[model samples]
Target: MSELIARYFDRLAGREDAVLTDLSGGLRRSVTGRDLPDLTDRVAGWLAAQGVQRGDRVVAVFDNRLEAALLLLAALRHGITLCLQPANAEAQALADLAAGLGARAIISAATPCPEGATPLTLEAAAASPAHPAPDLAPQTPFTLTFTSGSTGAPKGILHAAESFLGCAAAFNRQTGIGAGDRFLNVMPMYYMAGIFNGLLAPLAAGASVVIDAAFGTPTALRFWPRVAEEGITALWLSPTMLSLVMRLDRGDKVLPAGFRRLFVGTGAMAARDAQAFLDSYGMAPLQSYGLSELLYISVDDPGQPHFGSVGRPLDGVRVHLDADGRLGFSTPHAFLGYLVEGALIPPEPVFATSDLGALEDGILSILGRSDDIILRGGVNVNPIEIERALAPLFKGRGFCVTGLPDATLGQKVVLVFEGATARPEDDEIWARARQIVAQGPGRAQLDARAQIAALPLGPTGKIRRAALRETLAAAEGAA
Candidate 1:
């Protein structure tokens, strides 16, 4: 792990002109490659002074900034395991996570540390002298990332530097993203996608990255302008973000000249939206699939994109469907294991993902999760099929179909939508949705409809289906 950090720094040592731009507050703070190591070393020295040692766990809550990046590299160099929590995470939740991991210290930028952990501010850490890097084994665990917990309690997944770095290098090679390309990163650092694909992968490819705090509706509206300003060549966004961007009125506007490709993942994008994005921007958004357990499973080729398919498996990854049609994969970048009570539990050789999917001619197309299947009178109804069919009707809006407990049918399919402020009549919207489903294949499965002011979304912009289901149940009970 330390050796990898050493090598990365060694490569940047002579490239003093290379820069990493931090765009947290709309103001750019450009740090040269030469200055980065010095910042990292200072943080490492502060960590060492605070009694941090190799194998010790450190919790950090920071936005995308030069200090955050420095902390990550410093932690890797000093052989300290890092657990990155969301910057806006609840105080009690942060405390619980720190206690569970037995964290040696807590680092925060402007945020207060939880009780029971030593507080190390980013400002203070950066003022310390340089500390010598540590020696560590390649297999040593360096990062501990938590799952989104959309379905249940979040699990802490432990990872060694070699595993993730190898995956990043392979991804860069397979995707043809390298040196001259500029990537704009807006994903949160807490997630594996944000850390591996957003930061490390681009750095490994010798590509410059523009780090933004996070992507939201405002970011979507301003995306093209930023691309034009930064000369960005590549980007990785979620389907929700793409939909939001497409909703904007770009009258007489054109896509930036240097823009190369856009990668979409983390959730299924409707085929209609994918096509519209391609038609409007003159470049199709390449779809891909991956999970925290294993990084960079598959990515569609930009030159020959299949709208709904997440492309073929990358080299060193073996993917196949299980007997139940669940997507299963084994990759060189698979995590060490789930961290349970400070102990590492070995994961299975092949991970059976919660998602149901099909691999036809090496192209992977994701169906909804098995748990998301609506069993209406013993007939399995795929929500994705219904959602895709209704996508066009609710063009700029958000909607999802799920099953609710019913007296007669066992489970009844219900459509939930994100209602606009001045939404059309509920009856009218429901009737239109039902009409679409009736014309589609899952008409018989439809049972009820409801609307919420806004859909519950996770940090990564994925709809929180489990939470949405709970909300639906409460609404149903009220009536």
Candidate 2:
């Protein structure tokens, strides 16, 4: 009943005159703080009308409009367990997430909400009557987020109220950003990072956020000017967005006028991209490391550059390395666990994050993923390291490295290349990559080969490692 998160929203409700914005404008729109409280109340009222009792599982599938934000705050304020499914996901994916959350009802812009659930439209929700706030466990479920499922089926991560609150506190301490700051939300709200750190964190800090659900190169260019017009100070982006903005000269076009701090994550950002951001915009990008399981565990912070590193662990979080050299993380914001067959469970609290990294002198250096590594002749080869090195060699040519199944070695290294280079020998590329690796870490320990061919990328620009592996396997069989 007295949770800091609840108190935070209650405070915002009292200050109804404050301003918050959303993607209502193609770029951004300004909404007064006063309107937020009423909107939140109405959304909660709508939930109540739909038999959404406190702590009831309520899923939202509305477009990336302000209504989504209203639904989020409403559920949090009323102590409703909030589960958000991406509006753009396939029907099956949305159904799976809703079922996993045990959703009693789902809010959507579309009519005839999926079966097994009642539908509440944003346009019909009424204002909540004055009522005493419901009592809730400090560890009560607030948000149930699903992972991107890039590597596999998405996993549902449950977060308690305190852990959700702690993210804002951690962000405040790490970024020194606070009230009066304006934030732009470009990434989808379904993402743990986007919803929590990018949205809730700023809200908890009493700052204004502008949500833009439709994200693309053209949309980004169009939005930059609005950010300046709105006097927005900070924004968060994924690595993909960062690359697009840089290429579009987004900073030169608009950022210098209104934007200040930049936060980025969601994948490994290239050093070149970071450097390009700095050189062009004069804004130092803060890199963060976390997952759906942990909200915001570590951050590079403003002006602090660890180059390839994601940065030190956040305050009140512990990061350790296991005997196998895998990175283990413990934090207050860690998820309760994923849902399995209708039951919420607890995963390994001490996450052996498929990621491998080293902690030296308080700086954490990610060494790629242990799960994705290829083993050749009993030696481990990190595809990420190889990709980073080989990416430059291609020089605009597309390339990806992945592990292919091998009976003798467990997994054989396969490099997929695209683009016409005058020099097109598979053996030659292998020799060159090896030379680069020889000078880098795990020098002689890596036994790998390279093959050049057309590589495929997913819609998000990520290498389709799984598909590439299959193609390479066929090639190996032909050989």
Candidate 3:
């Protein structure tokens, strides 16, 4: 095993009773830590039998199951690089990604094996002989994650074993999350937040995690009861997920006393919703900022609550803004580089993110994405600033400010909101939104309004602005 994986296992060696509950596939099975490594060994043996060797890339298209975690550990133990593909990814996209990585094998639970790659089953792989773990360097590449691919093809981000494991351990220690905590994993494994924060970080701290199927809006309302039942202590949630949870009137329903410390990430949470959640739950959800390239950048300090800031940078993470106000960060935990056409390209010393933010008194507040800003008559209008201004007017409802293509200006500001009681033409919400934008800094003018049943969300529970823009454009064309 790589030094990092070996060290993690060593930390929990005597804690054989450490439990990992698998709530995937509608079945609950608690596997002990002692047996978990055996499963990983069996998977490693199976990969070896399939002629897979160290540094070979293996594509995994599985959900948040025990087997998926086992496979990931096995790959790390044997020095094989594992590329996690989203379970719902299209066949062609999976094929293209696997081909681009030159994956030696594809272990899929639902998707079919792509051409030229050997297919491996989780059950069969777990039945193989338990092979001894291999010794590996700390900097060995063990994981290759991809971007959301919302606008273009997903870019592969390679993470070294030591950096990946070290970041989780450091985050856990920094946050005071230890063996006493029980985390609930709701995010998909393909995302970095899912694999690192939700699963590995908790486990590294000797804490147990409850793995469930991917969370959806339909299940959002009823999820709190299960969380209470599971005695979940902490978990990372997105703004949209928290918003959906806030919609539930938990007047009579009592949450578990152990539940505390809700961390929000992926996107900004509306100020009104954040305040409402605090009023209802007696605790403000801590907002954080991070990216796939950098595991974690900053988080709100629990001791001193900053309503809109994503808190100070974590230890060893340097955060600054470029001349364009784009957030740039350098961290030891940053990914090695992007893998392009089977070749590894070294990353820059500092990763300049598309996000625009400001750091004041060591606190980082994300303004909005640079690309999401509206260019009204050549004046850059920050959508987040406008959204914050309109949040109170549309409290408890999903709303976003996006730019739509226009002839007169480069792009016009459009307010797309959710849960309208009437049609967009009849409701006064648009006028109210326009009035709020007019009062903002840029004197932003809303050119259009749209109403949907609910805001569209990406896999990680982030608002899909590109998709919403497309929806607005389609509506304009039809009008």
TM-score winner: 1
**How would the candidate models be sorted by lDDT, starting from the highest?**
1, 3, 2
**TM-scores of all candidate predictions against the true structure:** 0.93, 0.85, 0.91
Candidate 3, overall lDDT? Answer: 0.77
What is the TM-score ranking, best to worst? 1, 3, 2
Candidate 2: where are CA atoms >4 Å away?
A: 14-18, 24-30, 92-101, 109-122, 126-132, 147-155, 250-254, 347-349, 395-398, 418-479
Q: List the residue pairs that clash in candidate 1.
A: none
Q: What TM-score would you give candidate 3 relative to the actual structure? A: 0.91
Candidate 1 stretches with Cα past 4 Å from truth are: 1-3, 110-126, 149-152, 249-253, 420-422
Regions of model 3 farther than 4 Å from truth: 109-126, 149-153, 249-254, 418-426, 451-456, 474-479
Give the per-residue lDDT of model 2 (tens digit) for 304-380. Answer: 67767787788888897888888888787777788656677786768768888888777777878887887776887
Best by lDDT: 1
- Which residue pairs collide in model 3, if any? 1-134
Q: What lDDT would each prediction earn against the true structure?
A: 0.78, 0.69, 0.77
Model 2: what TM-score?
A: 0.85
Please give the RMSD of candidate 1 to the true structure: 2.3
